[model samples]
Target: PVVAAAPGPKEPKKGQKLSGKIAQIGDNGVFVSFGGRAEAVLDVAEIRGEDGNPTKAVGDDITATVVSVGETVKLTLKGKKTGDIAGLLDAQKSGTPVEGKVTGVNKGGLVVRTLGVRAFCPFSQIDRRYIDNPQEYVGKTLTFVVTTADDKGRNVVLSRRSLLEEEAKGQAEELRQKLEIGQEMSGIVARIRPFGAFVDLGGVDGMVHVSEISHARVNDPNSVLKVGQEVKVRVVKVEDLGGSSERISLSMKQLESDPWETAVDKLTVGEQLEGKVVRVVDFGAFVEISPGVDGLVHVSALAPGRVEHPSEVVSPGDAVTAWVTQLDADKRRISLSLVDPSERSERTPRFDRGDRPPRRRGESNRPPKVHRSGDPSDGLTSMGEAFQRLREQMGE
Candidate 1:
């Protein structure tokens, strides 16, 4: 008879303590065969920590506390073992906020990498303001808070802009206090509005008014200044015009040459200039000889030929060569003419229209004509007679 070797060491009974090497590991559980009639099944969770990540791997011989007796035995490795000090230290450090760089962007949020770990930053948590383009964050580095972490789920949520804004606000306030009028500074144009441009001056922001942009008229600030362009500006005014509030006005035109002063020397009577037609009105066409210096060319002086309106002769922005016919220095008025040559030629007559006949010495030098009102018989009443007749009719 084949001797069935005596049941090896009478395998530890169910609910009995057991110690064995982990032979196989799978998604379901770990199998521990201890020479018993049945194999013990230790759940994957029991082999791992609360995070669902296995603390011990295959081939790691561990002692587990037997919790039940059945075809499948349940065991707890943690119950049999003490807590890990190394893991506690790692947990403490992981919870601390860290710096991260944005690597990618998705519809859900931004993907940032920090400490060799991938983190997700939702759009709402990215910044204090709404972000239209998350891709802009790519390649930028920022600080982030560890909001959530799950080793088993492999999920890590982070936030950076929140931390940055908190730091930026403090620095901005400090810098704002140091700003003063007439201070020269460099700044980036952050936003352009109808009235002005907002420039980020270091950590603070200031306004460059539309009128202070250039000597030339600015209909819109964006036409000459672009967002993100760096420019130097001088602070013009700082006003505490209201309660607990302040206003900062900056100027770029003050840094540039004044067009009015530049044109002063060139502006004089009878000096000719090439001008650009700026506007046409019924009375005249205004031509810009220089940026801010414009002269009026009356319709009567537009051409030798009569023009009903200035617009019939010249349109806006047209280039025209004309002579400065007149200048009023005190009034800063300049008159241009296209008919200067014709006017001069007309003044110098080649020959007069002969001599006039001499009149009689003492006779009244007046022309004789029919006097209708003087003669009442002509049916027209004299002024004195009309007044007398009205007075009589009124019984005065």
Candidate 2:
């Protein structure tokens, strides 16, 4: 039988990347076949993952960089050699991510060991958020993207934040596609502010405004929400600001059943309910009869006789019995009266339809004029005094 010589492998340029299947595993390295004449060897150290186990097995497809081109093609995954510096440049151009070990931290940033060289990662590029204690990242292994590979790999700048942001954007896009307005979803409270709380809906974030936190009035978001608390919320709005920017509005109250849906069952017209006055406005007082529900006691309904102002009858936090006079479910309004509706029905009308009531002494249709710096007899002094007198007369 005549023996024939096998053709030799074609030479690949230094730093050239190749994708192929693993042909064989050896003690020294793993052999890869590109379905061409060549079978490249991947260094055993470079093939291992962080757990110190080979990431690929024989017959598995692998992508590796060419470190040397010769009779035997040398391939390296981590590119951790002086000869692999060219691979770093190729990685920079292709936006390939590489693994690195944090060697130290400095005033400028972190010192990362990657591609057999020390690279600088700016403090801002270390993480998605500002690192208050940079020392925490010291001696930790991490993955990074090569942002700048200038001076032939002498000055390499790496950014872990870029990789993280890219991943977050991908996850956010997926969530956005699945999200729908009025859809109920779960999220974690990432942060709380006076105005609202930011919730982490998977990888994306949405804001729950203070007004939307609960059915009852919320003076502070912190009082209702705490960081890292899991909560169910409804998607009230989703605005795409273009290029991966999004504004999401969430409401916790919407996830729960609306109080008005059952308000009719619990309330009846002309029936009295004891409630606490939550707020007092110039026109009326708002009373909370039940949680997540309020009724308005208008100035005219405050007493049997013609009332000058609502504050004279009730103040904020005052406990009073208010008779529900009207319930408009479509309008989500409940008109209330401090004086019983029966009592108002029995009382005489203050004036006829066309006639105006007689004005009393010192009483005028127009607001009282309080001149600043006026004498005490005129009941006005400084601007503060005038404001006080005006507020008093207005029952504020």
Alpha-carbon RMSD, each predicted model? 13.0, 20.2
- lDDT by residue (223-320, candidate 1, tens digit) is 99887688999999877722266677899988888776656567666777798888888899998888767889999888777688888889988999
Between which residue pairs do clashes occur in model 1? none
Evaluate model 2: give its lDDT: 0.82
- State each model's CA lDDT, in order: 0.73, 0.82
Clashing pairs in 2: none
Q: Deviation in angstroms for 45 in model 1?
A: 24
User: On residues 150-204, what C-alpha lDDT tens digit does candidate 2 reach at each position?
Assistant: 6445578899988888888788778877889988998888778899999888778
Model 1, position 317, has a per-residue lDDT of 82
